[model samples]
Target chain A: MNSVYEGAIQDLIDELGQLPGVGPKSAQRIAFHIMEAETEDVERLRAALAAVKTRVKHCETCGNLAEGEQCSICLDPRRDQSTICVIEQAPDVQAIERTHAYRGLYHVLGGAIDPIRGIGPEQLRIRQLLARLQNSEVKEIVIATDPNIEGEATATYLARMLETMNIPTSRLALGLPVGGDLEYADEITLSRAFEGRRIM
Target chain B: MNSVYEGAIQDLIDELGQLPGVGPKSAQRIAFHIMEAETEDVERLRAALAAVKTRVKHCETCGNLAEGEQCSICLDPRRDQSTICVIEQAPDVQAIERTHAYRGLYHVLGGAIDPIRGIGPEQLRIRQLLARLQNSEVKEIVIATDPNIEGEATATYLARMLETMNIPTSRLALGLPVGGDLEYADEITLSRAFEGRRIM
Candidate 1:
């Protein structure tokens, strides 16, 4: 039987398929799930989707997403201004916060330096970060880009740029996964394992 | 600096993460993509999602998703009422339609009989289907359930139930993937391969 819902369902699948990692099969599954979901649940998602753009804005100081002029992290007086964790995106800030591992300010680059994607240093918030550093309040900068090639390149680029300012820079540690088998380690991982070896 | 968008962005990530196959990383990526998308594009998705339930109905005869009292296949004069292609879900109907291989009517089982899930013949549209068969001119029944264990069990159960009637029944052919290696074929597949072997 021809369904009037056919076109709407197909459109939903197409829109969902646009998302990263959502293949057509997965998109169709999600579309059905959404269709079967409670009206209130679907409406919540729709309202959330619309509210995000209207309510959210970039933090004036950190470029992180915020509701007002200052983000929650920047407004929290207990946070350390002497150190700033530089990341590639706003969600990275949340990832760090979830761990409760660090209580410093954050600088979101919005994206990394991918010349192939036409993203250069100027396109990022690097200049603004540098300007913030010039005030001399931040003594240490943690370059926590992802461990992938692009992330490593971005960190390296930032490290060199911050060198002139004489701010101490560090990258996140990399090695084998915890409880991972040594035999399964690739050559690059084995090299990193050796490079990060301790005297203990 | 704090971002004004942080809370709303995080909310969107959380919502997207609830979808099937969408991991935390993928959810974050999708949230950002939605944020950057054209307002109208996102609204189209929202509208489609909202419209599916409001506009779509189930066909009284076939159980397929429909716009009006009956589905298109049920209403189409060209479709054969003398034969019925029974499938597990609405999307399966679309999958068959895409091939343009069958012009017979459809009967959506809603789901297969799974004792583990507490779903029996009564839970599905089996009663309605039997009622239709009693009154209609159906000569053949095509049990096109998925090739999985539950599908097989459901088909067997239905075949036994339909044994009381005089209509003939058939199942879709199943074997190996088209380009897959025979050496990698599972035991069940190998058994099917031998069982369906040609005389030539």
Candidate 2:
């Protein structure tokens, strides 16, 4: 792939190709774009790359990404303290916040339980969540992990752990998404939709 | 888009979104990936970005990206300098080189004629190409601009300009792409394929 391009350009393309979604062609396109882009824009990207790692750290309480010891959600006095929404990662917290629905505090588990990937209950921040619950007067827990296999496994594990704590625990309902046709829905989703149906 | 994440994370996401083909969702995903990536990887990307701008410069002779005054292709003595393959940009030079078909030298015109973007013949390195031709014993010119409107226009403009030079000039053939289904070929492509048909 670096056969034709010269020294610096080839190096840049190789680095860009290492990104998650960027392929060889896209890496070449981006490297060319950067070559043609304003110096200021490139400098900004470099600065952002440098700042993301050096300035950001995990929240001490929730394990969410934070600038200091605690994340903004943990520091906010206006947010509900009686309930905690347990999720897989910081991006999940961002997604829930975008809906403007959940106002309660959040607990990031870092990742879900996937034995194939060597991730288990001990590998996650479940103990930290339990410790936080013990210290706080939380009355309810919402397990908002993804609807996938790993997420489901994590939710079940967390539910079993929280059952003896006497606090009410719930999982987010799974059903057909809005604006989706019932005829096109997959069997699993359709079954869930039917099982979770409410009398209107 | 930056509603939830803290300073450094939000800044990284914003910068990532500015890249070509990268949307806000992808930006967030990549930013988080970077956040979780090893320090060595992040440092490699930063070094690449910094070195690309500082070390790379346009080829003084052909307008292609080069580490020194001239591009590798321009400096190579084994390449066929008598036949110069004229292309729209440096990436086109790369695409042609990847085929391992042509051994001729290349002349990059920077970009095709784009009136909507206010680019004209003077904006490109056309004069440099003409000067090179006048000073050299070149025999042929291959117009390998893109098959799009701007590329055709640029080819036509160059052909008219090169007519007096008496050097044989040719354009790349237009037809259905290899491995592409004939049924899915567009009307314009089908018409061109017929117009440019060759005898076995």
Q: Which candidate is the best by DockQ?
A: 2
Model 2 has a DockQ score of 0.79
> What would the per-residue lDDT of candidate 1 be over residues B159-197, giving only the tens digit for each residue?
888887977998887777789999999999888888877
DockQ of each: 0.45, 0.79
* lDDT of candidate 2 over B76-155, digit per residue (tens): 99998899889998899888988998999888998999999999999998999998998798899999999999999999
User: Which regions in candidate 2 have their CA more than 4 angstroms from the true location?
Assistant: none
- Tens digit of lDDT per residue, candidate 2, span A127-160? 8998998769898899999899999999998998
Superposition error at B72 for model 1 (Å): 2.4
lDDT measured at residue B55 in model 1 versus the true structure, 0 to 100: 68
Q: Highest lDDT, which number?
A: 2
